[model samples]
Target: MDFYLTALLQGLCFAGIAFGIYISMKIFNIPDITTDGSYTLGGVVSGAMLTHNLSGYLILPAVLLAGALAGALTGIIHTKLKINALLAGILVMTALYSVNLTILGRSNLPLLNMPNLFTLITFTTNINQNSLIILTGFVLVFTLLIGYLLKTDFGIAMRATGNSEPMIRALGVNTDRMKITGLALANALTALSGYLIVQLQGFADISMGIGIVIVGLGSVIIAETIINWLRITSVWWSLVLVMAGAVIFQFVLAFTLNIGIDANLLKLVTAVFVLLIVGLPRLTGRQA
Candidate 1:
């Protein structure tokens, strides 16, 4: 029970990344691999600031800005330089490794002694419960905000740019600018996930973002599966399901570990699990 509770908390912490992936992949139809770098960049920025006793208010914006800038750089490469979107993301992600290491000035930074968002306020004496409360609130606010954004005029244009770039462009929409803005928004949320997770886990490492994009991808895939099955059309419900998908993904991992899978093999297990999530539906659909 305790183990699963921790996983649940982790899922909440991951809501940001899930939302980010939904925006990038589902809305813009881009597999922005910059997620891997931006996530760690968020942790690096937050961890660096917290160690210096910075407030969460300051750290949060800094994390978002850093991630957005990284994403925007990728967008510029793809749109302005006419580079392939995937390759542009790969370039930025690769560059961020050295950039993150330079910023941290070390491979790992311990943040246990730092004043984190969870420690700033006390909802109850139980630390885990307090963390759960804060994380839930954080996820709720972002879900509502993103949901609202997706329903707005600009947001519709962004989605239109994704659904039919030529059509949107013909309608006087600046497709290039929309792609840039959308990617920036996606990576900003990804960074927010990093910021929250570092504070939760009590440390930050240069390698923390390695393969992290898969977690978000998996969550989005799970949400996509359900959305298709239910034919969910409401933006708010779709976002809610994405958040739930994040939690469900975590639970599945927790169950796998509980069944005594070796920690070393967890990544392999994760890959296989995601494959099942993605493939099973198609297999069933074919038979049906």
Candidate 2:
């Protein structure tokens, strides 16, 4: 039971990253590779701050701000320099690799002795219970907050910009600004997920985010396929379905591990899972 609970918590953390990817890829129609770096940046900043005795609450906002800035920089390069969006993302991701290493001043940062949000959960007792409750609360709050944001006027503009940038411009909406805002929000959430992972795992390695984008993309694709089968066309429902899919993916991995799978084989498993999900549409002759 305890192991299952822990796995669920970890899944929720991954779900946040998946949600961020969904926003960038689906909502904004942008292949923002900044997630690869922003995720590590979040871990580096949060872990370094915690090592310096910073409050966990303060670190949370700092991580989010760092991610948003990284994303906005990518957007600026794409919009102002007229670079391809994919190329802009690659540029920002490459720059952030160096920036993250500089931030940590090392190849990795360990948070074993630092105070984190999990430690502050109850402030008094029952550490495991408190941590679980606090994490669950965060997941619910973030999910609802994202749903609400997508229903707002600015959110509608963002959707419009993604669907047709020229049409949005014709409607007097600043498409560039919408693109920047959407990317910022997407990376902010990704960084927040990184912060949570560091808190939960007690360490942040520079290479931890190497293939994170693929993982998030896989979750999004799998979720969309399953949700489409259920006829869930609403954006909010789609988000919920994605979250569920992430949790299920983690559970499947955990099950595989429990069955004596080699630890080093997990990445291979992830890659295979992604390939299967990506090819599902062709296999089924259905549009995804």
Candidate 3:
């Protein structure tokens, strides 16, 4: 039971990345691989600051800034430099590996005795319950915020840029700027996931972000499947489904481990699971 509960908390910690992927891939139609780098960048930033005795709350804005800058760099490389968007994101992600290493000045940084967000406030004597409450609150706040943003005029414009770039451009909208801002916002949220996860895990590793984008992609894909099935049209509900998808994704992985899958094969299992989730719909459509 405790193991499953921990997975639930981890899913909540990953909600931010799910939201980021939803915005970048679903809304902007950009496969921003910068998420891999920015996520670790967030963890390293948080880890570095906490080691200096900084308040967890105060470190968040820095994490956001770092992630946003990384995203904006990818956007600029893609839009202004005429590079492929995918390649641009890859370049930024690769470069971020060095940047993250430099920031942490080591391969791994532990925060066992350091102050963190979880320690800042106590809701229950049980640490896991306290984490559950705080993580749930964070997820709720982000869901509401993203939902409201998507309903606004600016959000519509951002969506339009992705839906039809030429059309939005003809409408006097700067498509490049929109892409940059959208990617920036997406990576900022991704970084927030790192911020939360590092505190939960009590350490930051240089390799932590390796292949992490798959987690967010898996969650978004799950939500997309539900959206297609329900034909969901509401922004709020879509965001909520995305959050639910994150939780469900984690639970599925937890179940796999509980059923005796080798821990070393977990990544392979994750890949196959996501492939099924993504490919099954298409297979069914063909059969129909």
Residue range 91-209, candidate 3, lDDT tens digits:
99999999999999999999988878898889999999999999999889988998899999999999999899999999999999999999999999999999999999999999999
**Against the hidden true structure, what lDDT does model 3 obtain?**
0.93
Candidate 3's clash total is 0
Error of 1 at 209 (Å): 0.4
Model 2 lDDT tens row, 146-231:
98988898878888888888898998998888888888888998888888888888998888788788768877888988876677
Winner by lDDT between candidate 2 and candidate 1: 1
How do the predictions measure up, each by TM-score? Answer: 0.96, 0.92, 0.97
What's the residue-level lDDT of 203 in candidate 3? Answer: 100
Q: Where does the lowest 10-residue lDDT sum fall in candidate 2?
A: 120-129
Give lDDT tens digits, candidate 1, residues 1-288: 889999999999888899999998999999899999999999999999998888878999999999999999999999999999999999999999999999888999998988889998999999999999999999999998998998999999999999999999999999999999999999999999999999999999999999988889999988888888788899999999999999999999999899999989988888888888778878888321
Clashing pairs in 3: none
Candidate 3, residue 99: the lDDT equals 98
Q: Which stretches of candidate 2 lie over 4 Å from their true place?
A: 123-129, 278-288
Q: In order, what lDDT does every prediction score?
A: 0.92, 0.84, 0.93
